[model samples]
Target: MNKPYVIIHTHTSIDGNLDIMDLQAFEEASRQYQELSLDPEKQQFEIQGYLNGKTTTEDNITHYKRPELDENAAPVPEGDYVADPDAPMYYLAMDTRGELAFEENTFGYGGVPSHIVVALTERVSNAYKDFLRKKKISYIIAGKEQIDYDVMLDKFYNLFHIKRMMVGGGGTLNWSIVQNGLVDEVSVILAPIANADPDGHRFFVAKDPYSSIEETSFQLKSVQELEHDTLWIRYSVKKK
Candidate 1:
């Protein structure tokens, strides 16, 4: 494949909800998830870094605030910017409109440092790009109004040589990549408990009005019992 091999890796309840009912179980499962991401024997591929959706990043990292942008500033040169291509790892964010206000260019994950890379679109203002540049954050421009997953993945591969990428985004972002046929595998750390909240976030959700959910099948690859009654299930997406 010319693009990176994408893996949707997440921890969810047995009912496929993103909410964690049992804090202990969630913490244990999360520990396993981090270990599994670095397990070379289990993954059989080098994981460059993980990707998160814009909303997830904002909720957890940026705290839902807009960056100070100078709309009247001079336009940045066209194309993707590579600030630290030689970093040991990366933390990628899907911010199509460049709304993320990043104060730093690197994030530490599991004691390993990762360079921050923001996925953007042409619709973003020049000031936002300038902000990223000032922070020394690298960014890639894929689509005009929205992100083109194919082009974005290709750029990730060619620019950063990301052979394998871990998709740790929420349900909407997960389903978006899966429906786009860019994901190679699905790895879920199923927590033993389930959350019955009707409004609970699911493992996969269709949020785009223009897109319809297709019935995608997966071939079971492996099942392993983990600590705290959590189960690790791996599935390879069946190509249509």
Candidate 2:
């Protein structure tokens, strides 16, 4: 394949909601999710990184604070920047508009270190790029306004040599990539409890601008029951 094999991995409720009411169960499920990522036998391919959308990164890492940018700074030379190309693992954040203010270039998951790679668009300010450079973070520009996931994935393979990418989402990102037909597999850790909140985040939500997205289907791949009544389900996206 020209691009990396994309896998959408997440923990969700029985109703396909991202919100789970049981904290204990959620933690257990999350632990299992991490284990699955490291299991050599289960992971036939080397997963170079985990990808997230801008909102998810902000909620979990940045907390919605805007980055201090130099609006009057000199324009940065255009192109992708790879600060640490040889890093073993990565934490790929899809911040199309360069909204994230990362404090560091590395993220830790399951005690394993991963270099941060921010995905940006041409519309981002030069100051944001400079901030990332100061932090030694890697970045890629793939679109003019919105993200062109296809081009981003291509660069991931050609530049960073990321052959297999695991996408850990917050609904909008998941649906966006899947709708673009970029995902290969859907591996979800099904939590036992559900928060029936109508406003709760879902496993996959089509963004407002993606109203014309077609209904996609999946072919069942496998299912395994985990502890605490949690379940692991894998599906192969049915490509057109």
lDDT of 2 by residue, 65-144 (tens): 88888777777677999998888888999876888878889988666788999888988889999888888999999888
Local lDDT at 223 for model 1: 95
Give per-residue CA lDDT, model 1, range 6-46, as digits (tens): 99998898788886565788888877887788554554347
- What lDDT is reached at residue 184 by model 1? 89
Worst 10 residues of 2 by lDDT: 37-46
Candidate 1 TM-score, true structure as reference: 0.93
> Which ranges of candidate 2 are over 4 A from the true structure?
20-22, 38-45, 210-213
Worst 10 residues of 1 by lDDT: 37-46
Question: How does residue 93 of candidate 1 score in lDDT?
Answer: 92
lDDT of each: 0.84, 0.84
How close is every model to the real structure, measured as TM-score?
0.93, 0.92
| Residue pair clashes in candidate 2 | none
